[model samples]
Target: MPIIRLMLVFLVFKSVLSGVYGNNSNSENDSKVLQMLIDCGGSVTSLRNELQDMKDKLERLRSEAATDTYIRWGRSSCPSGATTVYDGFAAGSYYTHSGAAANHICLSKKPKFNYHYSNPYKSSYIYGAEYQTYESIWNNLHNHDVPCAVCHIPRSSVIMIPGTDDCPENFKEEYRGYLMSGHHSHTAATEFVCVDGHPVTAPYSSKTDKDGTMFYFVRAKCGSLKCLPYEEGKQITCAVCSYSP
Candidate 1:
């Protein structure tokens, strides 16, 4: 009987503390909502309803985009943007040996993508260019389509650069470490750029001959109209980006 009385007293004390700490239905519900969000995957319909509600609220403020903000690029935005002006599929993939040709999507703002995946560098087959194809996705934007095609793709095809058996003598340890660290994105080489200026080039060497060709897999980096699209195999340089070399 004494133990039971103590247990009841503890429960009452706990309730009193909770009340003193400003407990309310709204706060409780909000906490429940947050937990629901954390456990979001299991409740598809509820999530969809929540998303739809968000979309409805968003539409009141912005122009109605054809796709949801979180929707995959090509799945909805790409074709939707392309079809906003034209009548055919623009960003469809079909066993691509190379990505779209002569496209550039670099701009101050990243246009909606057909597909976006985080940490794309380690995923061998994924390729996202520094620019998206403005011409292809023009209808989706209010501004002039700069018509750039920076590709972001995952490339797993193993075409080894034949000449590269060792690292360059002056290759910065920081750059090498950057690669070894499994961080996919390399920057303006503020940290370290290739001596030859092609950071993603093949064989880790500037040398390109019949035995091996330098291959560059691309990723989508931040840029603006300054970036113009080139073909998948087309060699680009500081001059091509209009660096005034």
Candidate 2:
């Protein structure tokens, strides 16, 4: 099946800041908290720490609210003691074989605009992403406008959906949102270009976007090496292969 189920994989990242509270919304309580942090000169990191506590509480509530989601879609047991939690997170960011997305980053006025890798493998789930993904949301994490599709997948053992399987919790998308990243090898799945040259990405062991628009060469008829996702500034297209893993 096309990767429709998405897993709420737990991903961990470096603690630069705790979390950004949504203050502009109708929640007066949230507005007060944001003002308090700003007035107290709380560093973004420190504020996020405080906000994280709130998230933890919310997570508990969310977990309780959707207890069946964990049981149904979450991993109940690892197969033959496979090591989960790559780098303390069940999920994290990765470059896919034919995946395309804008990497959020921070920009200092540079004499020239160019793209260079910080070293793709060296990219971390939390800290490094601050430059490419989170921070890049709108230059220095200032703009809170980001829209993305949140796809959930079930546990590793449960690849295909059975007739009786339940769906995972539906998370409300935020202007600035949360993602389970830590997926280094997941995006590296063995995707291939068709003989007709259309990009064909394989299903991830964990999860993948069902909406095929994320892959650059998805519909393009480029067989084998003839298929290449056209890369643009601050955005890119690539393939993911899981064959080696």
Candidate 3:
């Protein structure tokens, strides 16, 4: 217990003892009572320290739980030092649908369905994402269904940096790849994402033109956007980086 609380407890105990003893004082009895108080104080201090230690441990666990998570596109696994929350297929809206969502999603491999079927009418759909362009840097994973993994890293923040495959200083690179999104002239727009450098197809996947959400390699057109560090017709690279402070 705290020193102030311990002192209060000691004072209370002394008051109770004096009330009971009522001036029938003996030195031996007083010594025994003092020793008892010291023993009790030690026990209280030990218990308080243990409780404080447990509180510290719980705080650490909470910090770890509030982690950084991101989707590792074109890969079915997480990188080293990261935990795989789940491996799944990359899915998004059709590339030609003008009213569809602009961002992609990782569809869980093992999905749970509700007992009641809610929608019976026509609605928007999510289709499997595919790599539509071939690039030599990616080992030619063209026209293949993309696999994605949801990854988690404790006590960290992650970011995807475009234009260069290397991470910034003080940041650890999770994976590096080509930057991609829907084709420029497509009816539907899409947000750019970083595909894995060593891309892999989904399990039992084949090369087919099931034109869902497509990953077309991004290129730099550097007229207004910086031509010094970048050039036209050159494919842009991206790096997924994480920092733990």
Candidate 4:
């Protein structure tokens, strides 16, 4: 009887060991499956993020391409029989009038404008003599009362015509009209029609006066004008012009 009992105990122990080994094998297989799933999920997430970034870049490129139109014309494109009156670079500076109680710049003598001078209000003005180079204007600006100035290269001719609201003949708008700031505390003027005898205008007609103020014309259309960097206060004006082909 004792011998029979020992054989039965040994059989029971072997059966328990076999069950434990089977459970461990199943657990190992389950762990491998879970790891694979995790890796695949991470890859999918990374791919989605990359695709979104690519889409954003493509959209920005398209928007820039649509509005980046600037036609560059040389001196040869002037109208026939046109007498070039002022054909050099021009610079203007804004300053506070000593007793006039206004902030403006006077360019009457520099370009020799015969018309009644319209003093447009501005915060800062370019210093030094007229028609200064960028470097010279920059240097003079530092020593002046206001540290900001506007410079331009103007080409204009004296062709008399009835004053009309339209842009001058033989000229085309180069850039969409927009307000340009001196990047300072004061706003600059935006309504001056002729710079160094050149017929020019802000493509879109509007006014603003604020720090860091700006606007861009959409679709080369005049009506879609909007202000930027804040919408309140007076705005300084800047002009963009090009010779007509």
Ranking by lDDT: 3, 4, 1, 2
Candidate 1 local lDDT, 24-105, one digit each (tens): 4355654554454445434766778899999989865443322221111111112222222211111211123233222211
Name the lDDT of candidate 2.
0.26
What are the per-residue Cα lDDT tens digits for candidate 2 across 1-245? Answer: 11121111111111112234223334454455445544454465578799999999996775444311111111222222122221111121235433433232211112253468545664334211211123342233221111111122221221212111122333321111112122333353322211111211121222322221121212223355243452223232221111110
Model 4 regions lying over 4 Å from their true place: 1-25, 68-245
Tell me the deviation in Å of residue 231 in model 4. 30
For model 1, what is the C-alpha lDDT against the true structure? 0.27
Model 4, C-alpha of 66: deviation from truth (Å): 1.6
Question: Residue 64 error for model 2, in Å?
Answer: 1.6
Candidate 3 backbone clash number: 0
All models: lDDT? 0.27, 0.26, 0.86, 0.32
lDDT of 3: 0.86
User: Per-residue lDDT tens digits of candidate 4, residues 1-245?
Assistant: 24464446444544564577654545555555445555666787799999999999997775444321221111112233222332222223332222222222322223554466457565533432121112421232221121111322233222212122134556544322223212232344322222212222222212222112111111121233344432434222233443442
The TM-score of candidate 3 is 0.72
- TM-score of candidate 2 to 2 decimals: 0.15
